[model samples]
Target: MEEKSFLDRMLGHLRETCKYYTGYPKYLGPSRVIHFTSEREFVQLLHQGYPVVVAFTIRGNYTKHLDRVLEEAAAEFYPHVKVLRVECPKYPGFCITRQRKEYPFIEIFHSPEQAANQGRVADPNITKYSVKVLPFNYDQSAYGFREFFKRHGIRSSPDPK
Candidate 1:
């Protein structure tokens, strides 16, 4: 049997990880379409007043569990923010490759990397974005992500008036 193409792999991964929504609540302001499979969609999300948080995870041949979590959060908030879970291949290069100067990550496109390259600037504090390196089969992060964001004063939706 032939192997799946990279685009097919990415699209499949996206289908398993994200939930597409048509609109968001009015209080949340506006809904920004999130495209996890394409970099262009990510850039659009950034420009549309929505902050994109990419949660890196791994799943064996499929990604339904991650998608369920992201969908649940999206439904609760709708438009204030967007969350994407990226599936990283299980390989040693995953640790060695630096998308940006200081951030060695498996994700191909990292905003901080772009910023770092355009200007000779780097964030000295690395713990700000430190994520645990989980095994290929371990689904959970070392930190409860929703709680971590809450602790950091990041809200799922805008406060009620």
Candidate 2:
């Protein structure tokens, strides 16, 4: 009985360690979409100099649909545009300030240099970061996102590092 109990505890610990390393289990996949985990992660992503597409969404079919679109876009625009999604319900405190009246609010954040060249102003809400945030109000499709990225000068191919 003692050995069985010890084994169970070991298994439980292993499970938790896997969860920590893999991130939210539901999001584990080949998809390039980076699940928003912390403000620190967000800041790091912004500083990487790639255009980031952030989607603030609640749990719903529409959010799932948007996730699929973003996954496709991220796959196509790898190394050029990074895609992230913050589930509002999961992180209410983090999303509270960025939330909109509607669900699945989308925003594209441009790097500081890119924003400056385009004459875009930095978002006051994100004072610490110099990224320019533009509300995405176009069609919610992979093609739409690709076109939007193209329009904003995000190259379809990865920039030569």
Candidate 3:
């Protein structure tokens, strides 16, 4: 069997999320939209010690894959890894604080894996993430995302890595 590349591995998780998403409305909270109201709420996501894929949306450019990513993470990893989609309009201050220069991408919190798949060379000072802010990408494939989470120490699947 051929070994999967990081992107393939990550995309696999999103593909598999469909199974769990069909029932999303039944058990999860509020209408499909997810939000982070405060810095504390945002920190709460990262504090879980798991990787959180936080998407920043603006001007109606919806990030479609993130929902699948969230569903997949919830289905496969449950409390281990998660995705939070925040609308930039409602959270104007949040965006300003992060100094966001781009829109419609995923912002990860509490992750130290260098975003190897997302393309920023691994930050040399892993500890700096606690105080300094880092830029993130939202362009990787779903398979790549799963590997990103696992590589960062957030285990999601029952399958052996």
* TM-score top scorer: 2
Superposed Cα deviation of residue 143, candidate 3 (Å): 1.6
Distance from true position, residue 37, model 1, in Å?
Answer: 2.9
Give the TM-score comparing model 2 with the true structure, all chains together: 0.67
Error of 2 at 116 (Å): 12
Q: What are the per-residue Cα lDDT tens digits for candidate 2 across 1-161?
A: 34568887886667655523233333334889899999889888888888888899888887777877787677667777899999888888877876477888899987654233434448645433366788898887667787777687766665588
- State the local distance difference test value for candidate 2: 0.75
Assess every candidate by TM-score. 0.42, 0.67, 0.53
lDDT of 3 by residue, 1-161 (tens): 99999998776655544433333332333333346678777665665566666777765424565565555445444555566777788988877766767777666665533233443538744422352233454345456666666555545555566
- Ranking of all candidate structures by their TM-score, best first: 2, 3, 1
Q: Give the C-alpha miss distance for residue 33 in model 2, angstroms.
A: 0.7
Off by over 4 Å in 1: 1-35, 57-62, 87-145
Better of 1 and 2 by lDDT: 2
| Model 3 spans > 4 angstroms off | 1-34, 59-62, 111-141, 157-161
Q: Which candidate number would show the highest lDDT if scored against the true structure?
A: 2
Candidate 3 colliding pairs:
7-144, 9-143, 10-142, 10-143, 10-144, 10-146, 11-142, 11-143, 11-144, 12-143
Identify the runs in model 2 with alpha carbons over 4 angstroms from their true place. Answer: 1-29, 113-127, 159-161
Model 2, 71: alpha-carbon shift in Å?
1.3
Candidate 1 whole-model C-alpha lDDT, 0 to 1: 0.44
